[model samples]
Target: MQKKVNWGILGLGQIAHKFVADLKLIPNATLHAVASTSGERAQNFAAQYDAVHYYGSYEEMMKCPDIDVVYIASRHPRHHENTLLCLKHKIPVLCEKPFAMNGVEVEEMIAASKSNQTFLMEALWTRFLPTTKKVLELIDDDVIGEITGVKADFGFKAKFDESGRLYNQNEGGGALLDIGIYPIFLALLLLGKPEEIKAIASIGKTNVDETCHMLFKYSNNRIANLHASILNETATEAFIYGTKGVIRINSRFHESTSVTLLLNDKEPKDIFFEFLGFGYRYEAEAVMEYLSKDVIEHPLMPHSFSVDLMELLDRVRKEAGIFYPTYDRV
Candidate 1:
């Protein structure tokens, strides 16, 4: 392999655009290929991202020898198939999060990766952000004392369109599988898998979750309160409280640039991190680092992490009466 890592992108959506921009930020990484169902869209994305190859057929791109790794940003329902395609070609994959429609799909993807001996990791961008790193650092130092609870909420008002992925059950539309995963991941990163989970959700006219709320109980007596919705606007922030102090994330905490520390009664101190492009570069860098080391998975967000996370999503959705297929919608 050359010093430069060649990347191929599937699905020319908004997230793919952001990821391509970050690909340019990494000196040793280059966007070499792109594919979309629409040839025009694929060509346009390739032109904009300086990709050398563009195809309307994902299979064609998978056969391209210039591509070393592929990023799958397709609709949630297609993640399993898209990942399998790359793994079949012995190409590594960095699949965008909500790894698949459910735990079943996630397990299959993991099996494919292991069976093919190819690299695979879910692209949960926030896990590699500067703010998250600092949060983990603070917690490790015990600056926040014994952790007791975590609270997070993410929501927005989206125009109702049942045909769109955001409201289509077949496309894996629902607050819990979409934005809800953010808060759940944050809680898991801090507290591990919960001992007990209670979740409630409001199913919209489209049979998708307009809103979802979850409470998790840990063996250590810690609990996490999380919420996600598309029916209304929310505070969209996160707070972690401990016996000694609290760590507060700014609004839109998942992608926020700053993390504030408020210990006991002391004045709040904010630490800021300025990032290039869309902050997806951090994850891209991590992937490159892992590849350079000949590793099949990233420790920060490994295959097990993706599996565990998907199981949590599965449990929450089942308890809330959500299903993956449109036909299964109640």
Candidate 2:
């Protein structure tokens, strides 16, 4: 039998709860430890998740032995620091996305991973989803002929709260970095880096982009139109256009379980996938597999990819004028 991979999670936020629940779905993955700034919250989270250990402070958690990897589920601004802490202790890390506030921090994180010889991956869960695999397969097989354009959007109505993470500039709040990343990820995956990016955003009272619209023009004449918003609810679907037809990712495309294929002079077909948990298990499983192989990075979501993604985000922020004073170095 394969040895189980012991997991540690930093931060006790909502995303952390969802991630731990998915960890249960992987047979070889076990929740060994959890840590939070609040001692009571850490203890409570540990109890709820049945973690073997819990630490009130992140620094203390780093000292725990036999933790195969640590998931940095902290807020956007903390990702760089949290990841560096794990790498400093030679602990592998799977950090939540928008990997860091900007490209410079991402580069530093990559450098740390290289210097420490430890595994590191940006937890862009959508990249590992079954639906994504199918979409890629279809594109590769020319189910949709030579791709020409892509259009995707993700949005939700968020109540304005000046102090909440979603609207607070200090917390890295903004639709572009929060929900907008989904559309951006899809475009980058399908279209590569845009040669020229044209973007504009609606900056809210809290100094964060409430809505962001991006147009990416590629050298090969391919184009991508992407949008992200926290002010209104959108279809949240993704459409990949090609010379022959289009592949439509169903609503809430980021976590979508189904996709529809529309071919020229053919019928529209819907593809569906069934899975346990909230779809985070796939990335966790991938990390464990890479760790077993003694690899330092995930091929599907490599450090280079994270670097490129962050750099692209920096460009978009520059164009949109979205700045987080505490974290923005670009």
Candidate 3:
């Protein structure tokens, strides 16, 4: 029998807790260690999850010989540095969404991973969801005929707490990098990278985007309409239009339970699939399968695709004059 891969978690935030809850669903992976900025928090996480070890600092946890892979769940602004540190330790990494603050940082991490022969991948959990996979298959089969457009939105009202991370500039709090990434990823998956892009956003007092409307033009003459916000809730749904039919995804495009298709002059067809909470386990399973084969990255979410997505985001951010402090580091 193959041995289980030992996993170390960096940052015990709310998302980390959700991921841990899903990690229990996989049999070939084991939670081995946890590192948090606070020793007290680390201890609490370790006790709650029964992690083998806890470290007050990430550097300490990265040095552990037993940890085969590290999951970086730090805040967006800190992802680049946190991932680089794990790469320096020669440990494989599965990082949270948005990859990094910009494309340059993602390139640097990719280079380091290649040089170190360590695996690295973005934890774009939606790409592996069952509904998404089936949708891709239908697109490939031309079930929707020639694809033409995509529409997706992810938005929710934010608490007015100025000190909260969602409203703090230093924390990289914004709709563009947070909820916006989902709509962007959906477009990328179906249309590949866009050839041209334009965006408009509502800037907040904290100098972060509270709402954004984006347009993507693909080389195949297809287009994507994407939107996100931190002020008001959206339908949280998606529609992929093609020449022959349309695919409508349910709320929370990332964790969809079913999809409906309507062909020209034909009745609407409904497709359903069962998935565990939020569909995070699919990504975990993909990682386990690829890691068992010693693959550095999964094809579904390749490093180049990540780089392209980040570059596109960089262009949009520049066009909108929305800059983060980490851009200087690039």
In order, the Cα lDDT scores of the candidates are: 0.89, 0.94, 0.87
Worst 10 residues of 3 by lDDT: 321-330
Between 2 and 3, whose lDDT is larger?
Answer: 2
TM-score, one value per model? 0.97, 0.99, 0.97
Clashes of each: 0, 0, 0
For candidate 1, the per-residue lDDT at 154 reads 98
Clashing pairs in 2: none
Report lDDT (Cα) of residue 67, candidate 3: 89
The full ranking of all candidates by lDDT, starting with the best, is: 2, 1, 3
- How much does each candidate deviate from the true structure in C-alpha RMSD? 1.8, 0.7, 1.3
Specify the highest-TM-score model's number. Answer: 2
Worst window of 10 by summed lDDT in candidate 1: 321-330
Q: Between candidates 1 and 2, which one is better according to lDDT?
A: 2
In angstroms, how far off is 129's CA in candidate 3? 0.6
Model 1, 1-330: lDDT tens digits are: 548999999999988988888889889898889999999999999888789999998988887887889999998878889999999888999999889877778888989988998999999999999989988999999999999999999999988887788998778898988899999999999989999999999998778888999999998788999999999889999999999899998888999888889899899999888867888999988888888787789999999999889889988988888776642321
lDDT of 2 by residue, 1-330 (tens): 988999999999999999999999898899999999999999999999899999999999999999999999999999999999999999999999989999989999999999999999999999999999999999999989999999999999999988789999999998998989889999989988999999999999999999999999998799999999999999999999999999999998999999999999899999999867999999999899999888899999998888888888999999989999988698
